[model samples]
Target chain A: MSDVTAGALESYLTGRLAADVSVSDLHEHVEGWSRDTVSFTARWNEEGEQRERRLVVRAESDAQIEGDSAAEGNDVETEFRTMAAAEDTSVPVPETYWYEGDRSVLGGRFFVVGHLPGDAPVVWDREQRQDLYRAWDEREANEGDGKADGRAKGGSENDGGSLPSQFVDAAAGIHTLDAEDVSALADCPPDAVVERELDRWVGRYRASTVRPEPAVEECIRWFRSNPPEIPETTLVHGDFRIGNILVNEGELTGVLDWELARIGDPLYDLGYASTYYFAGKLIEPIERPELACSLLDREWFYDEYERRSGRVVDRERVRYWRAFSAFVMMTIGLAGVHRFRTGETDDVRAAWFQYIVPGLIEDMLAIVREDRL
Target chain B: MPYLEPAAVLRRFSRFALEEIRPAIDGEERFVRGQVGSMASTLRFLAGELDASERAVTTQENALHEALDGVEHTLDDHDAAATAVREALADARDTLDGTDDEAGSRIRGTRERETTLLEACDDVLARVEANLDDETARAVRRPLYDFLDARLDAQLRTLGRRNESGDGSP
Candidate 1:
């Protein structure tokens, strides 16, 4: 879509890969919301023998939440650096092969990584989700398992099932990383991580809002007035949830979309994934407790995080971050509405995000005030 | 001449999505069809609530005005920037509040829409909170914040507490 063609990719890779590398089997991905994803086969001659490399290239695109540059969506560099850091860690990440920020390389900046074979299921796709959940149900029925962050890598083709414990384990895996060890992750000044994060989304909000949002403004003031006590900074996967996770044959695969991953309160990610969603899902359960339970209930998710990460989670800290997460999400909606009204994209879903801003405000108030409106 | 009722059209389209569109598509397209179905239902729901919605808005706005002027919750100072915005909104609101006979047709019809005042209020409050000191900001902004939150709560109430299946994708 961005003048990215097979021939152009081949030309770029031919020089980058080897003397005579041929790019073929190229197809532009149709599923992602943010990045223009391209998956192709690159063949190269090494020692007079032909070798094929399966690669997925993440093309640099404008931020999905244009208002929030700090948002975890649509940035390629964050994903590349984060993946590089997680290369040898307990966190399962796709091997990043080569990254280039120079736009001149492929008409825009893009990064190539070894393609991990697994499907990162879209949550909106109810049919596929039902199938996956059914698989989870069968597994849970037989195994009697709901252990948090189950590390067991096992699944079958039909079931396309995975353990909820495994997903939590993956989150725990990222939380377990020593922030200092990952050279790619920058260190926040001691105890200023959350404030720095607040500045990030707040700046992004001010940059892209189409209209003034008093609810968000109030939430911002509240966060500033009531800073959560941060004991430590760990790798925060800004959007750590089932949607960004890849699953294959019930095995926990690599985490995708590291654009929002940052160094901050690790609990922020936990509250973010659960509070931003699950509140409604928990209400309906939609007849998929098997899948929902695997991911978890509210209390279960909190307990699991503490149990697996071996980190004490202060409820107030979570409450504060939950409010911030809601603010970040609301601003993203504002940006989306701006883009749509300005005709940046035609998706009505952008407007859909704005509609939920009211409910999310209620959610934030519930967390921050502990007094429901 | 006869025209199809809007609700009927939505239901017709909803049926088409179920019988023709959803079955005919696959991949993201099929999932989107389901979303279309969800949206169709919500729109139908909204259409049903439209009469009640207008009343709900009036009720909420009246409460907000009462709250804005309530003695117990009053701001210590107008805090200039916030005052400008609130004064402007008050003007807009007064224009809309006038009886049709009491004001010229042009003023009654087109001086400023009611939602415009509401948006201006939000804009003013947004600016006020960002710039003022935390103590002064909290005091100046609380009534407006409470009003907006209550307005949202009332708005949701009109919609009948239906938990919308929001953007299914992250």
Candidate 2:
């Protein structure tokens, strides 16, 4: 809730588009707690040519940037730069249009990106998945590339089938990005990213309340005791999942939400995606067969990634990341917990997360126990 | 002393918030209606647990003692091993629950300890449970399960998919 009005947004876009920018439509999406997404359509003229463009402006809200007190460098500028760096890569990122680096203009800095066309529906919907699988199956039989164009009537297929393989391939694509490509990426302390995130979350959660969670404390102790081997460092999409990426014409169109994108161990993304998948299964009680789950299990996922990337996968490292994913999710809950407890945000999602911190710790411990035993 | 219990009044308001007043609320906060519904359920749970949590903690403590006692019978006849386990549990629990001024303190200072009193107790209990045999472990964990199971259920109700009602059938 900055006092930056719709007129300010129009002025900014008008300068960027270099035309008479009149915002035809403008509305902020209420879902994202981290970044407020304002979707708008601008009608502008450039050199006697009139062009209407649909775009999205992502503005940072108050959340600890891995424990940053104020949203300083972790604003829309960072995402704008990251997207610009990732443009030439195989990764399907949105085209970054303009970044308002100075916060004074918009009251808080914001970035605009051209909205890519893709139907990014619920990823875990069995009916949607079944359709995607059937489309791929059809594509394999008829098309030369054997890649589905994301068009098929869902619900007939028994499993996700080849869709899982494609998803893995797309994930590995991010991992395969050369460090030289993302040259502007900051250098992290060697093998300290996990510990950094752990401390960051701990700081946030501790700040939230006088009450403490023993499970998380124990998990942190365990994490400190048994540090995993650092696999090759690459551009890790801090949040990677079916929901984060757009699926269009039966292929991954674009990866969305660059807010959490960073350069780190590729396994970070794998762990995050896997934990998210595991959490969904726990909550939704989807009736996918046990064998189907096994097919898309962590090991299978690693193997698929290894085969695609031509890099040898470490069993221990993958296991650690899988559990670490849960730990990260648990830590992330602390931010929401802090917001809820402080009554700064009236988000029920925040309140719900505050209530579920214990359960999150429980889930993390369960994953760690499974990994260990 | 009153016509209706305080919790009953809370439950009435909570139910009203979920079923009646929530549908009328719209926009961003409208999405939080389901969570508000969850909060209502949690309030009811807290009210129910208020009188019983002390007993639950005592039962868990006794369960831990019983688990150690079982280990002695399973291994040795002497009370040395059983006494040691009992002392260990007490030491962990006291360190967790007691302050610097209190007796048998395991903590250096009050603020030095990272986890809360209950968290410390849970850590000790978890460690104790992890060491025991299957039967002893189940015996030790049953009380904790009994205690937190209801709480977990209440919290879990909040985690359900928003905008979804009834059976999520295909």
Candidate 3:
């Protein structure tokens, strides 16, 4: 909603590109709520040569970070820094360009990145799931010869192995990165990761109030009482899931949405991604409820992640995080509902978030009950 | 009280917004168009839930009372249990009694009562985890879980239906 005009973008890019830039095809990506993303193609002359590039501008939203008052480490600067920190890692991140701190240029602090060509597939779409099934089937068929690239079998060069393998490899790449790399992320002692995360999220839930959520309260008490064992702490992509990453012909293009990235338990991402809620089980019962993110089998994902990352997969710890992650999702839904109720933001999507609250609570309860029983 | 009920009015407006207004918006203004679409969806959901909200709240109130009674009974049955557990039950009962306010309207009364009962549940749960054994804690949490289930059912019945597009799924 900020004043993002083509003229302003041209003026800004003219200064950055050191030439008269003509910006066109300004398209706003409205799918993500965390930031205002607009992608455009810029043409300019540099060093006596004509140049053109597809770039994206991600600006801070007017709404509070994640719509929660107590949320931290989700600012625009943090996101830019996190992406910059991951530049050398195996995780595919968009090449970060200049970060503008002045709001007069973009109406908010913003950063520009190279726009990679890919689509962030909707996980719940049946056609998309069918495509993923084919991709995985293709990989499984070529499992023996150590050359699993789909391109060898008459596919395009970018059509590497299935999205699931690339997904796990990218996650392993993130988890294997040293915590010191992303020094700007909230750092917690290895032993304190579970408690700190639990308190932080629970506090956010308690702070957000559209109505009383006794289920969350009960979960808070139970999780607090029974703490999970902390295996190893690494940079956890706090919101890791298929929908946040881009895929081109069954290969990962770029890992988008770094706002929620932080340093915490690596298993947290596995648990968060493995939640059936994201697999579309909570919305409507899908056929593959066991699939994580509607793309990969849960146990297979765990095995692959273990083999790739060389970290032991603890089912119990993953179980704890699964329940906790659902609780986290419920809390986020509550926060959105709270924002809408309080008229903090007029985004009707926030109002629609209420529909997911009950289902999320149910998911959390189901996970917790399974653990206890 | 008019010819068309409130829900009908809302649904008509929602349909107009979705089918007529949204398409009329410039496709280049994708964010605005998306907002219009979300507006239609929210209005549609609100229209559907308008009538069911009161019933859902009433069901929740009744379930809350039942859960409170069950917790009280469990506490009494476990008189030989830990002192802190007994005290937790007693404090919950006292809080419910002290916070009872029948001076408000039905909806307000339900909301306030629900809040008080939830707070009591939180207190009892916190204490129970610290004081009770595995079996005793499970027995105590069973009724609370039932209460949670009823609460979830009421909420879902009230605001659960999504459009065919599943716009906000996950």
TM-scores, one per candidate: 0.74, 0.73, 0.87
Worst 10 residues of 1 chain A by lDDT: A281-290
User: Which order, best to worst by lDDT?
Assistant: 3, 1, 2
Q: Give the lDDT of residue A213 in candidate 3.
A: 67
The parts of candidate 1 lying over 4 Å away from their true place are A62-75, A125-162, A276-294, A371-373, B1-56, B65-150, B153-170
What is the C-alpha lDDT profile of model 1 across A280-303, one tens digit per residue?
A: 331122443313322455465577
Q: Score the docking of each candidate (DockQ).
A: 0.18, 0.20, 0.35
Assign candidate 2 its CAPRI class: incorrect
CAPRI quality of model 3: acceptable
Best by DockQ: 3
Worst 10 residues of 2 chain A by lDDT: A286-295
Q: Model 1 Cα displacement at A124 (Å)? A: 3.9
List model 1 lDDT by residue over B26-77, tens digit each: 6545437645655555554455454455465555556556545541233445
- Runs in model 2 lying further than 4 Å from the true structure: A3-5, A62-73, A119-163, A202-205, A248-251, A276-299, A370-373, B1-3, B6-15, B25-88, B92-119, B122-170
TM-score of each model's B chain? Answer: 0.55, 0.44, 0.72
